[model samples]
Target: MRMTTNANRRVTDEQIERARSIDLVQFLQQYEPPGELKRIGQSWTLKSHDSMRISADGRWNWFSQNKGGGDAIGFLQAVHGMSFQDAVRTLAGEDFKTIPTTQAEHKAKPPERAAFALPPKNNGNRRVFAYLHRSRGIAAEIINHCIKNDLLYEDAQHHNAVFVGKDENHNARYAFLRGTLTASHFRQEATGSDKSYGFFLRGSGKTLFVCEAAIDALSIATLRKFDGLDWKKDNYLALGGVTASESKLPAALERTLNTFSFKRVVLCFDNDAAGQTAARRIFTMLRQQFSENLEVQTCVPKVKDFNDQLCVKLQNGKNSPSRGTRESTLSR
Candidate 1:
């Protein structure tokens, strides 16, 4: 085989071929978080980036980003932004050389995940109600509804507003915290929380609205109520956060799809770059996967997010534009 020097490192063609042929899923399982990679049908999807799928044949495709490759070397290059030389060297290491061809052949078990537990509740939710209604402009009824359903509460230790996410059995599986202090911008997920079970409200309607934060979801519900629409008639889900470069279908959104029979999926992400990118990517993935049965679209707020729009509406009175009035919808 021929040899080449890549950035002062000499590599043989046979070694490069070996690196390229390494199993991508096995590589990710070994290097990345094992829990993030989930099985979707016959293919494997990453919890962090659900649009990216690794086939049983060792091929990988990032459907949202419109990028894909045949093997592990290309995966590292595209996803991790690693150079060809570095990707080759990393895969050619002693540990990677003997990667199993299939999941059954891979015998290593993932490390045990920490147990998930909600923070202790405070004496009352006075601070939570005050902060959400006064600062976030969320409606009292909306906050009360969440509290009634045990989805929202005030943590005893820090007085942070805790947004809970539960599984099908109504077991709490995820928690997102937001500081109630005026000067504090603190936000964090509870340790061992699963992103797949994000904060959400299920409605009888067929449309599912997706957002980036718990406050944004509440803001949308508030806006719908302000517009004379029954807020409980439609579903709402928060993804926690998104990045401009992320092409993954969020674990939360994926789980929602599997649980509900939503006919239409409205992407209510932020109006910023990251939000737009995520909305577009998710829109594409849903359309392709669900085909004609599912109507995937984008309904971006005129401002940065739904929370900002809600605040403006409150400041300007009922004369302000309603939820869909100031928003732009993208169907293509």
Candidate 2:
């Protein structure tokens, strides 16, 4: 077998395979910051990019970016944009001893997770209300409901909108922050937040609608209100984002499907290349996962997203496109 040289050392194919087969979750947990990798049921997902997951068997997939690899070397190449030679050299170093070739040996003690907590609440929600209602075109009634239900609030220091997500026990486990300042476009998940429990609104109906962001979910509710329908009739979940892989499902959507008995799931992603592709892929995944037990569909906005559609309606009044024409749903 031909040998490849790195630095002054000869690299064998066996050594390369050993490096490639290093368990990704273990590698990430060892090198990344505490709480950067979170466990969601059977898989681990990156905290900053919830769409990426690493299975226990050492395979990893970044569904959003449509990239994946079978081991740590692939993770480094795909995520850190490291070249193949560098990834192999880094992983095969003497400083990082290789583990035994067993599934049990792949498990490493994860770092202690940071405590999850919501940001301090502002004395008033004036800025969040103004930003959502005035800037994002969300209805006042919808904002009030979110606040009253403890699903949304304003952070004291920055006055950013804090959208909360709760677990089955109804305890807040996740939060997403969005800046209220028009000039700022800051957005991020709160420290130690779990993406599996995303910001969502519970409803009595059996239909669950999924979107890319909390604001988009609210905009959909507002649009329903504009159509003379009850805004809270159906469940709405913000995935925080979407992944393009047809084989993988977002952690939030997976958790929601397991927690609730929904007969129908509607994808309301943004009207863009990434969003549309994700919607189509997720639609296929749902069919394969649930088969005839569930009905999967897509509901795309005529513009960029539900928020943009709402803004157009507010600006054009009756002259805006009809609700039927503004959004289209494809059943599968």
lDDT (10s digit) by residue, model 1, range 233-285: 88889876653323446778989999889888888887765568668777887
In terms of TM-score, how similar is model 1 to the real structure?
0.66
Q: What's the lDDT of the predicted structure labeled candidate 2?
A: 0.77
How many backbone clashes can be found in candidate 1? 3
User: Looking at candidate 1, what is the lDDT of residue 264?
Assistant: 84
**Residue 217, model 1, lDDT:** 93
- 235: Cα error in model 1, Å: 0.5
Candidate 1, lDDT over the whole model:
0.75
Model 2 over residues 19-128: C-alpha lDDT tens digits? Answer: 86566666666667888888865557888888676656555656556455456766776677665776787677543555455543545544345688899999999999
Q: Per model, how many backbone clashes are there?
A: 3, 1
Candidate with best TM-score: 2
Question: Whose lDDT is greatest here?
Answer: 2
List where candidate 1 sits over 4 angstroms from the true fold.
1-111, 243-247, 319-332
RMSD of 2: 7.2
